[model samples]
Target: MGMNAASVLNHIINGEPTTPCSSKGATSSQAKALTTTIINHLRLGRLGKAVSVLFSAPVPFPFALYVHLFRICASKKAIVEVRKVESHLVSFAPTPPVFLLNRAIEAYGKCGCLVDARELFDEMPQRDGGSWNAMVTAYSQNGYAGKALGVFSDMHKSGIFAAEVTFASVLASCASILALWLSRQVHALVFKYGFGGNVILGSSLVDVYGKCRRMGDARRMFDEIERPNAVTWNVIIRRYLEMGNGKESVFLFFKMISLNVRPLTFTVSNALVACSSFRGFREVIQIHGLIIKISYEEDEVVSCSLIDVYAKCGDLVCARTIFDLLSPKNLIHWTSMVSGYTLSGKTRLARELFDRMPERSIVSWNAMLAGYAHSSQWDEAMELIILICNDMRNTDRVTVSLILNVSAGLSDLELGKQVHGYMYRHGFYSDLSVANALLDMYGKCGNLRKARAWFYEMRHFRDMVSWNALLSSYARHRMSEEALVIFWEMQQEATPSKFTFATLLAVCANIFAREQGKQIHGFLIRNGYDLDIVIRGALVDMYSKCRCLDYALNVFIGTSVKDVVLWNSLMLGCYYNKQSEAILKLFELMKEDGVKPDSTTFQAVLLACISQGCVKLGGQYFNSLSQDYFIIPQVEHYESMIKLYGLHGFFDELEDFVEKMPFQPTAPMLARVFDSSKEYNNTRLGKWAVRHLSFLKD
Candidate 1:
């Protein structure tokens, strides 16, 4: 057979004429022999020889020979070979049968030759469902998701008979685009086309739902997939992890294990991540053991993930141990270790390691830069930025943003301007995130004119963060009217987020504009903001500052999860309104409700005590600072205590309290003692205060 392959090619393809049996071309013994030899060479892994013998055929090759050639080239993803076969096939048959042309289209698509695939498909006199499927699959697999969807639209208009593969490719496109609404519609079409029971197609449906965040629907589709494979299990588990349901994600991981399904390495990485987010050290330890048992500990991707989760769990020792064991020490492991050290504030050692890296990616450079930025090593960070700008490799937006952060930290408007120029020169200013960072840097570094210039320059590209950055800048400068006008303009374009409303309320609070505060609060509620703890605390603080104590208290009472901030806000409101008795009662309620008191909480409590002249009660609460709650008394707490004793005419106790305090009495404390001495006619204590104040400046 091998000899025949060599001999058959020399007869026809080597400048020898083919024997034409009829208009249908050769069907004689010679053509059959040529086709056989070509298949034999292809089967023997001699693709070059097969093509040689194919072109050297003594007659026009049969259609079946071309089918085999297309199938082989497609399987290997051999774009060069597919192109050769295509040119030869087209030169002979300008209008081949649709099925044969369809095969050629599919071969091109599989090789990621989308342009060639589309060209071949367009020139076809007719197309079946396979032709459309081939084009969609080409775009879908090449990550041209929008293009795939566009071609699928054309497919629908052509009224071609769609096949199972066509829907499958289209479904994949929807998944890539995260078009959840469209995914649901395609899912309905799946059942209507009677492909509901096909497990492969069913898994695609599951993947679509999972990536789109419909975990419940993803799980249901997964369960219906008979004999669910590794991919099926991975889809739901990863989605749950993405949704931040770490417990459920880990639970699914265990369930998959119990069913005797071996988790893929990808699945193990996600499970390790979930363990970091919600589980304990022991669970991560178990995953480490599983990795060793499965022999995946050496896999770089899984190893990197284990290192990240270990670092996140505050076990950098173990993370470093795993990082050291990797043989090749690729960029990922290097970046992960540097990031881990930077996060843990071991910047000196991180820099040492970063300096020794064999190679560097943008992420590696960013990790090092971030370490310097986080540790506030301004000299090293600034120097590194200069080095990065001079390097041959390109720095991405993250690098530029971190550099901007360093400039903002130093409040160096000159350095920031240089970076802005770098951005404009390199074309990164077009990216919205890069533009947003520049705007924030300008605002922070005291270059408001430049900030607004860049902001208005990118008006067409502004997202919510863009508007918020500008609004926050105005708020920071106390440009109340300007901020209000910006907010109104923002409402016409983008919906206000919780942060947006919070900034507006802060603006109102600063000016004590009660009406504007109420208007913002109304807009906040009307827009259905979730009123998370941050927003709720902001609202309470705003209302209280606006002198609406009743409204502030209403916000406090309506909240089900009253954190310490809420209690403190209400208590401070009471102190502001001179509701000393109510402040005392709320303090008791806060303790009873098990809300631990911080320094701010006790300040409000002590201030209320001083207002009411309750010296003994104030003393007991002061003792509770170290006794029960372990909160160290700040200077304000000591000042409040002196006022409490002095206003109530307790002269001797005031003198003793000041003398036995952990430190020497502040001038303010001694002065309060002097006032109480004059009011109560205690000349002896007045003399003692005068002695202390003789040399101490108030």
Candidate 2:
């Protein structure tokens, strides 16, 4: 007979497994061959063919089959195929190996199937620290901080030693949750495992403690480690800044330099943030020097911070200089420069820079809008709002808030109405910030009723800033009763901020309502809030307005950290209360203590003299203002002098003074001279005023 197909295959299968002729059973060798074939097909990227071949085989290579399916499903993002392998595990009577279980968990985690990952973790017959760490890391990476910590706790109970990666992930988890207590426990465990000194682990711990606002603990851990790397020093510095200890942050930064530790780019960037946070230009310049030494001063992040510092410090020249020197100006750098110009009230310069940016983000648009708002260039601000609306990228919350502020500054009811329409159309009217902005705009635009409606609508979703903004709007519009009502309402849910009280106190001064003022004062004192300069200033102004000089004095005296502006406010308070003698006394006290009074102080003193009918004293103070303070008095000063002269019947002296003045008189000046001549009935002064007024009009 001819060689049959089976007979021929058997003759060739000399070293291979013999066929099951008598029994319908496959040998282990045949199974091995089948598994090898399926795994090879999977490795070749032919997953469909591998599945088909394995399923068609009389015997199954369960391990290889599961591995093949897992790889394909994980790679293809195919959830169904991945679940098939998981379901296959449930049907198997024999337990899968530990490596196989870990593989399944890893595949699930990498695929972002956290639920399956957790289920697999819990179902593990026996788990090592590696298994626990994997689950914890997955949970942490997926933003599940609580579960990550729970897994870590389980790892501890199981006595599975945490490796370096485990500590890193868990420490990061603690930082994310801001769980200081759990983080401390983890830190103790890290030290116990002798991984405390690891550079990466130590750095992570520093970050964790710093994020938890435990700057001292972060510093301690940093100091305990011998020869910390750049990352370690950076973490400690970042922590100091985050904790509002900019002064200490600068100290530690210098310490790092003394220790010959070179800071990374992030270090310089964070140091710049520290400067911005503290409003410390001195420290910013120091950071600049360090950055330049390290050849990172010109980096976009560093330059952006420098620009922000100079701008916020009202040093527009320096801000512009830094901005100009940047090699490739990015959106952040442009935003900082433009924002600086805006805050400093340099609208033209800000607009020029805004127009010059190569690309503008929503931040850049907001900066431009803010610049216009701050400079009181309302028309331009409104125009830009329209332009921002036309641009798709400018539809963000920041842009909306900025436009609202612009409308508020302009007090343009028409423009504000347009913005409100835009806000409603964009579905941003429901956002509390947008709503607050609208309320503030309406209040500023003399639409207090509209502002009230918006405020009432926002009651269901109350945030501190929104409430404060509404109160401030009421204060600004002299709606004292409404402002007080909002203040009382805010107290029911949110804690009243310094700003809320400050606005309420401002309302008190506007209406000169002593009863309301005292109520706020009592609340401030009871809450230990009287020591705040802002609150004290408002209180002083309020009491002074109500003619309660003793109360104003007490508030001023109670302030421990009085800013120069606060002291000036107190002096003005005295003047407002008709206590000219007290004003002079305060002025002398301010100068004697080396407070270095500015031009405003001199002007206030002159006004006090005029109010007291001390003409000669006013003249002496005015002359001193020009000579000593170098304050070239404007028309307002000259008008005050004319009023002083008319009151004392010193027309001859006024005429002589007017003749000696260098500047051509403004219309207001001529009007003042004309009015004074009418009172004194001086023909010569009257003729001079007519000529000057005609010239001014011409």
Candidate 3:
């Protein structure tokens, strides 16, 4: 095909003027053929020959010649050849026109050769905002936010009136930089320039606020707009999901749908995330159905999001089904499914799928490690950490955090120390997240001394997790005073979270610190954190343990909502106060309210029975434990049984049961029953107690 076309071109070029027999018509035909050949060469990117043919041929070249060459250089990012074509244009019989300069600017911009593009824009004696917009766009595309802003400023200073494209480019810069203040300034300029209502500008404003974590502002802008495009809806909805307002995000989706705004692939993906965050299977299915209805169900982004949504919401089977159907699975799709299994505590299945993956990313490894850590499978988590440590490609702060978390659950002080050494050797000890995890691990593993050392060593700026870890450590070690001190420090320096109040409440419960507990309660109510269940439960348990039963009761009754654990706290408080009637009433109330009693409830009830010598009720409840509640009697139940039996003069039965029991009685149980023989004999209860105590003591 090439040879035929080239021969036709040669014949036309050589025969054009020599024949002279009405050769004007022949020459026209030859010129047309030569131009066709040159176009084909340029299209094929045979640049040398195309340039030669253009320069050597008698046929005149069109503007298409330079434009084609510019495209090839831009696509290949061949800056040298692009400049060559420009220089050749200058030597042309007439200089290339303004239209040609624009093509060159676009090419340079696309190729990230902004310096050259800027030079060209400056060299132009006559300029327009379009030319300046091109330069600003080049800077924005290349991640040069500062340069983009500077160019935008110059464009304004030169009195080049801003156009929609100009504002759009500047907004891109602000969004990249997360410069909300600058973005607002740009919005004002857009309004000043009569481009405020532009769909493109409105979308950029929504995006800017979302990036700045100002979702409310973004929503306000979205609502203020009379009409919003799909991009506007997508940006706001995505922000809602990121902010953990999944319900609001879904509401926005419904609103968008009501307006008949069609969703794109991005919209479907975001809606799927909202579904996952809410963990509403029905809503997820609804979104999935909508995706299918919109014909984006099979799209790569949408399908990946579907797998993620289902996996996050614990629909692993559906996630796996979707994974099997995707023809070409990427890393993200595989990672999502693996993360789902890991998070759901199905580590074995997650590991199986992880190994089956054709390839893995660092995120996949992190997911597997985190799964093991979360499920308390410490050995496996540590093994993966060792593997990651040995492998040069996989080591990172996230991996270290996973391993540290596992160590925290195991409370293996020795292994935690080893991880600290490894972190130091790798120069990762200074990484705040890694350091925080290490501090948390040491705290959880009961090495509060070492945890405190690491805490003080951390850079002065502390995050919530840092403070929470330290406070939790002190609480676990019964150092309530120190924990309270740190908590107040946290409140003074930073905003306290539910974890902060919860940890402090735990300390108060441990030491029965009533004054401190009330202070935290006041803080909770003042901060509007009283309704947070974790914090509320902590306060209830603290007040109960501190012997402030009246206050505890008020808080407990005031809250209309209560879970099983909350009821358990109240019942335990009654047991501690020796208020047997209150314990029974609370248990009946719990049952009436449909809150199932747990092991703690059984413990509290048994203690109440032992306190009052309610043998008939104790035996009945003990039998109910095994038959109705399916609770195999633990050591505490046996201790309570022995006490009840000893109190009721069932000496032989207690003695025989103690002899055949699976474990030894605790020190307190022995002291309470056997060491009281003097008082027992004085009270005429000697014979019964001696019979049970003789065999166990011997």
TM-score leader: 3
Clash count of each predicted structure: 1, 0, 0
Please say which candidate is ahead in lDDT: 1 or 2: 1
Q: Score candidate 1 by lDDT.
A: 0.84
Instruction: Choose 1 or 3, whichever is better by lDDT.
Output: 1
In terms of TM-score, which candidate is stronger, 2 or 3?
3
Model 1 agreement with the true structure over 441-479: per-residue lDDT tens digits: 888877778888888998898999988998888888888
Give the per-residue lDDT digits (tens) of candidate 3, residues 1-698.
47855564454445433222233666567656766777678558686676566556554444555666677678878776667666666554244467678778878888888888988888876666677887888888889999999989888887889888878888889989899888888888888888767888888888888888988788888887889988889988888888889889888898898899998788888888888777878888887888878788668888888887888888889999988888788888888889888878999999998889887778888989888888888888878877766754647888877778887887777877888998989888988899899998998888888888888888475688888889888888888898888887877767888888888888888888899889878877887865666666777788888988888888888878788788888888877777876777788888899877777788788888877778778878877887988878887788788788777666566666666777765555655556443434434334444555566777
Alpha carbon deviation, residue 374, candidate 2 (Å): 2.4
Give stretches of model 3 more than 4 Å off.
1-63, 76-105, 113-126, 213-217, 223-227, 258-261, 324-331, 387-392, 421-427, 446-450, 526-531, 619-698
Highest lDDT: give the candidate number: 1
- Please give the ranking of all candidate structures by lDDT, highest first, separated by commas: 1, 3, 2
lDDT of each: 0.84, 0.77, 0.78
- Cα RMSD of predicted structure 2: 7.8
Clashing pairs in 3: none
Task: Determine which window of 10 residues in candidate 1 has minimal summed lDDT.
Answer: 13-22
